[model samples]
Target: MESGRWDELERRVAALEAAAGRPAGPGEKDPTAPATFWALEGLRPQAQGSGAVVYAGTFRSEAGEVDWQYAHHVDDLLGAPDAVAGVDEGADRGDLAQVAARLAALGHPARLAILAAVLRGHDRTADLAELLNLGTSGQVYHHVKALTTAGWLRPAARGQVAVPAERVIPLLVAMGVSS
Candidate 1:
């Protein structure tokens, strides 16, 4: 990483630590980041039986930046006694079939290409077809429809399409892990 980039990151860390009523300095616990995995530490106590998992990160793109963290104790999915308290009865709960449907939507090569193109600023169906050399605009629309229904992409102004901001990191992370 460049020195300037590190400097900017340190500055941001200093600002965050200052807000948290701590000082940022070398050899001291980074106030901006916990000395340990805060998410894992929190999950370990409550996650029981089948165990738990967590995924989180900061993502940057041409469109914008996103900070995200998510965790699920397997007990929660199975409604075990160890589940998180106050979960809505009507909550999606990431049931197996629903998650499979969403994952299936990204299984297509064309859909993945469309998502990648849109993230890189080519949001138009025609542009995506041309840029990715996938197929006709109609076929692009087909892929776009699947992505939209899966909540991975959305219809934008002037017939363009976009990945919703919250979905951006997940999409990139999914793609990265698959690769």
Candidate 2:
């Protein structure tokens, strides 16, 4: 790439990263570059003025594979970070409450184990109980209900469940980022 193009790419990546509230790693390539951070770049316009939080990933497990990408306007996702410029108190109360509720649903260790287990093909209540050593199907059912109501998991074939295709990347990103 020419020096000018490289510089432009770097600037865009920086903008995207800054909007994402992520720190740049050493030797970080330009996210705005093609096949790199296409989601971020595509969201750049909608994320304009208010910025955006974007994440994407591909996951292959015993269950199968998931290729996903997602973006949320910063105003919709980050009202409490207090670090991003222009993040005022103007964020929608309902959205923050909903996001908080969803995060709260994922706050339990057993719940996370349930999600990880389901992602790995242990989608049945009994399979999840056995795989996670939860001791009882009732305990597994409690977590399943929470995850399902939170939209992290959904009903599938009889007696099984699945993480919706759209939530896959976000769920992984949430776990990975928090860890």
Candidate 3:
């Protein structure tokens, strides 16, 4: 949604909260939270009992309207080894901080190009500089340092750089670079 419209909606929600004499605190329930929570709360018993439970909700604002559905299945994968492999339902402040830092490191186009070059086997500083048409190796090193600090790259044998094994797929996915 457009920023202007989102801002307007935020203002409206704040106004509503103030009128209700319960101004929301930081990290408090969002504008739609009360209604959504009420709706879900009403379904708690049914959701706790049986098969898959589905809840459909809709939110309308001056900015836009969103219709969403949530499905819950209790212990659907209790014994599955990989059930929680990539699930991140609740991340703490430190996890979010690290994620923010890593994403910031990839915010630059040059850093992305450097990562791409490394993925394509141009792992040396000189090779990356030549491939990216960077004026000097220093520029290439600068981007490399950012990526390395973000845990996206590490030193290999000799003076070459390499994407850590576990990060290779995630890095490509982040860059939207197809295999």
In order, what lDDT does every prediction score? 0.80, 0.82, 0.69
Q: Candidate 3 regions off by >4 Å? A: 1-91, 177-179
Local error of candidate 3 at residue 9 (angstroms): 63
Model 1 bad stretches (over 4 Å): 1-39, 77-94
lDDT of each residue in 60-162, candidate 1, tens digit only: 7776788887777776655533222434434444454467788999999989988888888888777888899977888888889999999999888988898
As a whole number from 0 to 100, the lDDT of residue 54 in candidate 3 is 49
Candidates ranked, most accurate by lDDT first: 2, 1, 3
Q: Is candidate 1 or candidate 3 better by lDDT?
A: 1
- lDDT per residue for candidate 3 within 30-134, as digits (tens), equals 563457566656666666534444445443433244455556564441322233453443344345557779889989889888877776677877778778888
Task: Give the higher-TM-score candidate: 1 or 2.
Answer: 2
The per-prediction CA RMSD against the true structure, in angstroms, equals: 12.4, 12.1, 17.4
Clashing pairs in 2: none
Model 2, span 97-130: residue lDDT tens? 6777889999999999999888887888778888
Question: Cα deviation in Å at residue 53, candidate 3?
Answer: 19
